[model samples]
Target: MTRAKRRWLPALLIPLALVLAVLTGSVQAGATVSLPPKTADEVLAMIARTQVRAFSGTLQQTAELGLPDIPSSTPGVTPGAGTALEFLAGSHTARVFVGDPTKARLQIMDAMAERDLIVNGKDAWFYNSADNSATHLQAPKPGAPTETLPSKPAMPTPEALANRFLAAVDAGTEVTVGEASSVAGRSAYRLSLAPKDPGTLVASVSIDVDSETGFPLGVHVQAKNQADPAYSLAFTDLSLTAPDPGLFQFTPPAGSTVTTKVLPARLTPVPDADSSPKAPSPHGTRVSGEGWGSIVMLPAAAVPAGLTSNPQISQVLQSVSGGRALTSSLVSVLILDDGRVLAGLVPLERLQSAAAAQ
Candidate 1:
């Protein structure tokens, strides 16, 4: 994958996965509340304090976005199962440890191999056990204020999803508290958020937060008219103590190919602008409005060769004219016939408006 795509794909998926990652196992519906659920205002207050600076846990992520039939890996495939694209359609498990924002580690367990992202201070290491390869990326110097990076974007984590959506708290959102529940054997409070905008496809989102420290234990997203969550992530096992420091250290296995990248900070910063680049995003993503009504413009060229070559992709393409619209409860994506891809939390019409302008 291109470095550009690699940089943004994770960020794009992580948050949406909180809202779109669909899991298969039955989520125990009934909760025996050890303590009564908190009020909405109380839950909101707890969210702010739930910044887990040190913790280790095993998280399960499931994606049931009702996406198009995509490709998977075979036995002899080199970059076999668990490719990033495959993350959008199945279930996966991850081992996560966070010492702080700059010190964290995530290990994705696959069928026969795994991928590890280790961040320590300003240096980040991405190691793929499948290929025994590593990518070393240097984040901006500590205390630097620049927002954009020339080489790669910031690494993403499940915790960031909690902060991202919670930061959107405003008059446009309706917050409430659901029944108390259990996650990873710990008691948690269910906090639900629903956009007041009728145009949004998101029906509602509920996050289960640890009652003790307030860290998010699980996130569930429900789409309009859907009974089950379109995406979900929850911990099957968790610990509040710090992770071993050695987990954040990496030397790259012997004979492993290592690629080094230096990220240059952006000259000017625009808030909430789309970071992903496509054919038409020559100057980066152009964002309109904010919060619930925001739309992102992503003009692109013709269909990418990678997509056209895949029979399943081609068949899906044949089902559409110039573009295709995919919708979940919280987001909408418009893939234009011109190869441009527009996405946002707004309705299909909003995305069409952005594409029409391009």
Candidate 2:
């Protein structure tokens, strides 16, 4: 793996389709042991510890979300896999180092190449060795109550995935604790959640937390009516000590192409807002619904050429009425004839409903 590639892969790949897939059962570790079980109350308490903050370790990601057999064109482009098309439907490993909330490095290891995401405060860089390209972003200001990075549906790291599940534990969820287990040679507790909303396709989501630090060691998400996890991310090895500060810094190698993008400033509310009729915001891509059943809507004009021009993608689209609807065990996406795309963990009928409502 090149140093540049090590700085960008995790941020891009970890949140793609079925990025939540994880291995089931316990990893065989030496010496049998026992640990205390956690009650629902205790699990709730651990969920509140969202700022466990820093850790360094190796992450194993399994993505078998039942994605279609997407054909690859360029070295890193795979239509319909989102930005993580390069990592679609496979097993991969990456090294993660987080020194604090704003500084971290994730290096994904591949058999022939590597990629990395490196962030220090509001500066971030992504490099892919397979393509010899580096992307630089002037991240939106950090710590602003309203600031957010722009992306279709921002991908979250494994640590952030823990927080995502915790945030989903509302009145619509059923919570419980699983058996005590070991992860990365440390005692851990399993917390599980099942959505009560019939609109969602997720069967359940489970998190394994390190008993000592309250950090999530693994996450398993099962799709509705499926026997196996749709996606998961787990730590096979970990260390809680602070990582070296230098690990978060980055410099592109000579001969690598570099591109830069700056996020737009967030809009601020104006005074006397009620005095004037508000203008309808221009139509664009946005997500509807919430959590597991959430649907991403992309206006046809906004979709890239890869989605419309590819023959395989075209076949998938023309095979069914109302454009096209494709599904895997965990996810379903509907492309409407009007040039809009809807996707989520819900059934195709749900996506169709969302499109009709729009």
Tell me, what's the RMSD of every candidate?
7.5, 8.6
TM-score for each model: 0.75, 0.75
What tens-digit string does per-residue lDDT give for candidate 1 at 178-210? 888888898988888887878666677777888
In model 2, what lDDT does residue 4 have? 12
Model 1 scores a TM of: 0.75
| Number of clashing residue pairs, candidate 1 | 13
Whole-model lDDT per candidate: 0.59, 0.61
